[model samples]
Target: MSTLFGLLRKKMLAPSLASVGFAERGFPVTPSAATVKLEAVPQAVVCGFEWAIEGASLWELERRLELVEPEQRGFAYEGATMGYTILDAMPGGGRNRTRELLEGPGKPHIFLTYIGIGFAMARLPRPLWKNILPELSGVPYHPTMSWLAVDGYGFDRAYFDTRRWVDEQLEPEPYPWAGHPGYFSRAFDQGVGRALWFIHGGDPRAVAEAAGRFPERRRPDLWSGIGLAATFAGGCDRAGLAELRQASGPHHDELALGVVFAVKARTFSSFVPRHTMTAAGILAGLTVEAARALADRTEVAPDFDAPEPPYEVWRDRIRADFSAGDQRRAG
Candidate 1:
């Protein structure tokens, strides 16, 4: 049962179902059978957020989250973790709820959980950003994958304020997240790229055109985001995936990098959906097994002392491998 305060928090902070609808955001998503499934993704996140803010116990939360379908269960965990991050940041609410979720049943879903923390970051004041990520010593990908939070932040901004971030192509001021201030905008653009997949209702042509609207410099990161979303979220068919790849053109390697990451995340969760496999084969030119092997071989150790974050290093390694293969083919 929720306390009065918890209920109040839910009422104040949780977004309504209608708020995430395509029409509500004025996105040009044409009505179709695919649209309903695509929209449900965000609504699942909203449900998870409400449950967590309502002070549900971990066991109760796990039960509720498990009820979500396998494909979207991770996203619900994303919302719940976001809610917990918000509660932890509030005055007199330092229950370490985010830590509990991430370190416990939320472990497998750590990738999405970090993104959820970013969603909370979107709602919280800048000062509280520091408190959003909790220390998870010995956890496999704690700080390194934490950059996904920024990606999540970018997704939130673009999804909510499309005119400024997406339409106007406005760039966010840099912050020293993960101690790489310069890379912040790039990570954020990747999130915006993910949003384009949804904003365009998984239409390959629309997503490509939207990315084209941005300056040439930002398209690579945006294409990377699109690749991640296309593989992981899977809104389109095999032909559509090929179309997206063709549209990527010069940024094809970056798109493949995103596909590799998405496959790695899914493999980590121990559930590689058929669509994800199909996407990997088409977008990255790798089978699910091959993608997982590539991600494993290219994995970088978490080293904050290094010039670049291990996350980017890991990404670069993947991109380089793809480029090498392409060069060999050209020869």
Candidate 2:
């Protein structure tokens, strides 16, 4: 039921499964069970993109998305959100598609859905960025968490153009996303940190090294991103997670903060895989329940009106708790 334009959009925008492989991206990840699993995550995203761009109805998309296993289902929804976001930005495309998805079945996966909006931003013009976020006023973390879209944008850029964003360490010019231009670059670096996980194929040492390569100030955000991806997307085992923790050095609290957020997201979606639980224990030194409690305890109100967005405040509270060694008792 796709229009000709929708078909063409799918053809042009949806990435091939093979393209997401580490080898395709010139990464040095060895062919292993872990690498294969990591690759499948993006492939799932691509599937969602194809389905959404092909004009799948909400019911149809939900059916297709539900077919994905629980652990990876949120990621597929991320891709579908991205596809719908892109469509919504196009000429003659109404903006309600993203709103409908997020307000309905996409609500559970709202965290990832915001990141999907970032993926769409990578493809759209700057002028179109304003219309990207829908009015989800009563949504739990709508405006504040929208920073994940910027994070997602950073992830997309680093993933697709490693030489420029990663190797060259080019800083993106700041834009006033969510009215805080100062924090934009930090959120972007968080996404770059997430990319480092994929770029290094979840090698704990390599990810640590990649993060260290950035300037000292940027390392905290980068480490935070790495923690989120490593825990949520999960390419490494417990020992590897321990190694990542060890390698984090002074940013260990920042890394643990990311783990807490990842746990919150997974728990919010009502699907915490064993790997996430393992990562929480190894990296954050807390059980999943404890991590979720820490996140909830530190969460800022949605209407937190200040120079800093509530998202950063929430992150800061968690980070501060980690620094004080208080997160372990959060549960």
Candidate 3:
């Protein structure tokens, strides 16, 4: 009965997309992953999700992020909401102001700051965001990327303070995970990848360079987040796509697999009104119909929108697609 219900949901999901104008106009995936001029991407690909942020920019929202009492800073989505709001205002004219804040006191909230900046990047005209990459090029990946563990603090802190979210780990993992140290860096890099997609202006080459800076073992999860942004937000060019494929190294499938997981997490949210068929279309290299079909084939029922167990399943599934020592190949 559970399987049948999930199958039905997945089936309905596709048609539901078509009903609300998430229709794929069959724009061919970029041939070489070169920068796809924003004008070239079919307007059909202009996800309506970004339209919401088009309103008046909330002033100093990022400033407020710093001000939020530590307890208040820990809510599940509020910090992100704050991040998006500040970026929406294009505070200090978007990246210019964020560039300063990236180094300023808001530095601690770098995870939320960059994530919100990514949200801003999704809305802005391209190349504007892409140029900022050079400013970040000199930075190291680990500590910079690991700051994302701060993004997990709300959940981990909640668990620790109230015993509320997940079973507390016996001791902290090296990186934060539901109050565990395990996978902390992975969590951090995932945020970095999501933000990197936007920072590179969806250029694959930039993404590759950014991902390249990370230690090799760390690249897969980072690529996974990049894939998520590239898919959910629809920016990477042919070269970017190819770079992602190549850079996935051993974790290529796992990286692409993140798109599937992110699609599920994001589509269920009110944040993406088109239900992400467009994102699915981008990642699967499919027309709307084909993308929908693929999702239906892989869809499963999970009580939580972003369940953890299947994340591992998708990760391992990608790994299994490769034999021992098989590396991801770029076209």
Candidate 4:
């Protein structure tokens, strides 16, 4: 976003985005993953970083990013998938393609579509977000929702790419992956709930059912993702919010606490989106003073460093809090 107009647009939007709780700050360039390094990272992510640093406009960057075929099927693919989705809508529009992906045999890459919506989110504003998200009302908790992690990446990169928000970046480490047997890269799925929040327009009941559809072992993680998204983008009513928590069964508090911490941490960012304020309201249970207090508490946490591996840390923290009893209760 370093182009003259992109810079000007960012400058104009940064303060407003910050006010809404969206982080306009860019991520660092350091490779902090336990297993990877700069050169070893996914080519598109690294190349995207280089492209941004070199002042590629969104249009110019999309040339490579939007292409469906990848340079190489590196360890991580969502980053590149997100790049494609940002340039334009999905094939035959959002709803049709999403439905086909969901109802058809290929369930895995379905998350790719959701994350691709994040790219759309980067280019389009919240008012128009519905354009890319399509209405998947009765879609039953499709597993692609698990790819909500990709959606999170899309949101993170769309709103906070170092190239776009050049003022507050640091060195980044490698993007985290679940290693070896891969197992669908839950490491990458950290923000699945948040993206689900966006995909379902913050419908707590829908989010709950979606999480429930996952398996006994996966519910807590799914709920936590929902909590993150609810805090970041959900605008549920109190009753709906309560239902959201209720739907999570026993892990509701843990989910809310994680999302609260996430929202609180991001509040320190130099930029935010307009919906952030609404999300802050949801995080605070719809009270501004409470939200402020919530923010104040997280502002001083010991491990809250912008340059660290945020998504991974949050996941670890939530899982650490999750107990067998809690899991049973949730079940």
Candidate 5:
């Protein structure tokens, strides 16, 4: 964010008049084996990031992300597979292709939450609207919901946050994932509940290009409100270390270490997605060990031979391991 914008954001986030909480909670953790059964499909709104390239369409962008067939990119793990989904309604065949990848015989989709086009036009500085309007004449967008404050990367946290918050507000009881009586409290208190996955090895410009700009107003504030509330509700932290270790054994150790390093390197919060750089022993795998392992080795060390899809190689492994039956209960 630009200095002017950052200051404005900070001013807005500061505790005062209507005090929307934006706590310093780290990233939330994906539940363990025992917790999976209890894990409800969160009433989430899938907010995807997109960029409107001059010549490129969302279709092409989605393909590059899927990295499917003959694309042969180094350090292949499932980053693209994790975040964002393409809407099935899109023209041409991209939607069908995405559906086949998601619902087809491939790995059971777990991480992805929604389908959206990154507002490719969002990257422009808001102040430049006057001069840029002529070039943006043909763009199609819902005026009321067109732009969302997604930070510099075009990632609008407000949509996701709003989804989660709305659920919490309207639900009669706490969410099913709330776990034990005080579980949510402790989780938020300690910062173990908020998390974001960081994908590796994508062109930066591609990402930026994909994350076009949107109107900036209450989006960031709204997202910050949800984020801060989650923090107070039991956000992510090192507290789960002992439990995570006891449940997963040596593998958990590696994951915990990696999580630690990730937090240290990226001090803002573990949820922040840095460029995909590998650090040893940090990429622990419960089910997708082969894929995670290969990813860690290649992304970190960068060695010979183009690797196969980690999900393809370890599909069975992830199915067997990370499944709901074997999940570990943090309590």
Candidate 6:
């Protein structure tokens, strides 16, 4: 038995004899290699049940078991969640600001929840709330001007499409499973986006319904565009998309579209920053932004009524700015 289990067993079998029993035996309460293996047994398929191996290697299975062990002992536990968490931490604004904002209250107050700011809002639990007042109020008042700061431009639309694929069609399999990317995708579609619409401006219930609507055909394209954006930019905003064009330069309208798509899919508060310059950095960047923007606008079905004409109009102005940038780049 493992040290913990041995101690537990002693407690269960003879509550008062635990200390004395170990002392008399002169045995340290440490878990032996055998005990570790014994404790590592897969509980879900153990005891009297038939143990059959499917496609998983014993090593992989063991690694998975180690993850849930609570001592930071499993690759599965770290690999899956850590990757998603890292991805989640990338988006509009700086990763630092995005993180501070998502983890706290933020400005534009789009993704962050500030009681008195850009839009109406409410307070959050102490543990959940992330205060951005200090960051926003800092010297030069240099609030993150571009969404590209978070490096969300690096994300590809396929990331989300893969999630959509597994979700809509997946045969049941034994062993534990996770949809980390799916969760990130949904967080944008359901959590962050919904939070932005209702918490920032619309009715919560209606916003919830609206956010749930997504096009089947566009899922793949949309995911691909987002993945591309994560590659170059941090976050997506009307202004940031325009900057992406400037920063990317020449024949790169697709990048512009990709960035736009990522923004529409989810607001970018938790974006990471990307600094590498690809060979066709300028063209690729511009192309991504344009593609993403087009994807976002086109994917939205025509029948929905406009709730915030002023906001939508403002957004259109931003889109037009990008159009001008595209024309300039083309010229």
Q: Candidate 5 on 60-158: residue-level lDDT in tens?
A: 434453443211110011222212122222223133433333333212211221112122112233333222211112221111111111111122222
Model 2 scores a C-alpha lDDT of 0.91
Error of 1 at 236 (Å): 0.3
Residue range with the least summed lDDT across 10 consecutive positions in model 1: 300-309
- What's the C-alpha lDDT at position 105 in model 4? 22
Instruction: In model 5, state the lDDT of residue 116.
Output: 20
Between candidates 1 and 5, the TM-score winner: 1
Q: Model 1: number of clashes?
A: 0
Regions of model 1 farther than 4 Å from truth: none
Q: What do the candidate models score in CA lDDT, each in turn? A: 0.92, 0.91, 0.41, 0.42, 0.23, 0.28
Regions more than 4 Å wrong, model 6: 1-229, 232-254, 257-280, 283-318, 328-331
How big is the positional error of residue 69 in model 4, measured in Å on the Cα after superposition?
34
Among all windows of ten consecutive residues in candidate 4, which has the lowest summed lDDT? Answer: 20-29
| TM-score for candidate 5 | 0.23
TM-score of each: 0.98, 0.97, 0.41, 0.39, 0.23, 0.25
Window of ten residues with lowest summed lDDT in model 3: 43-52
Return whichever of 1 and 4 wins on TM-score: 1
Clash count for candidate 2 is 0
Tens digits of lDDT, candidate 3, 1-331: 1245334433432122233221232222233333333222212111211221222123433433334334223121223433333343443535443344444433443433444343333334444433422143223221233223332332223212322221231222353323334555455456555545544556666667766766677667667777766665555545455556666565665565556644543432323323245545444444444433444454333322443433343345444543332434431
lDDT of 4 by residue, 117-197 (tens): 444355444454434444444343232233343435434542334243112222122332212123333433344444444
Q: Superposing all C-alpha atoms, what RMSD in Å does each candidate have to the true structure? A: 1.0, 2.2, 19.1, 19.0, 18.6, 20.5
lDDT of 6: 0.28
Better by TM-score, candidate 4 or 3: 3
lDDT of 6 at 327: 83
| Local accuracy of candidate 6 as per-residue lDDT tens digits, 1-331 | 1245334432332212222222332322234433233222212212101110111222443344343432212212212221222222324312242233323222222221211111100111222213322233432112222121111111111112224322232211221111122222321221222122211122222322322344543233222233233332222333433443443332233333434433432323333222212211332443434534554454332223444222223334444655677689779
For candidate 4, give the lDDT of residue 274. Answer: 44
Q: How many clashing pairs per prediction, in order?
A: 0, 0, 16, 28, 38, 70
Model 4 Cα displacement at 252 (Å)? 1.5
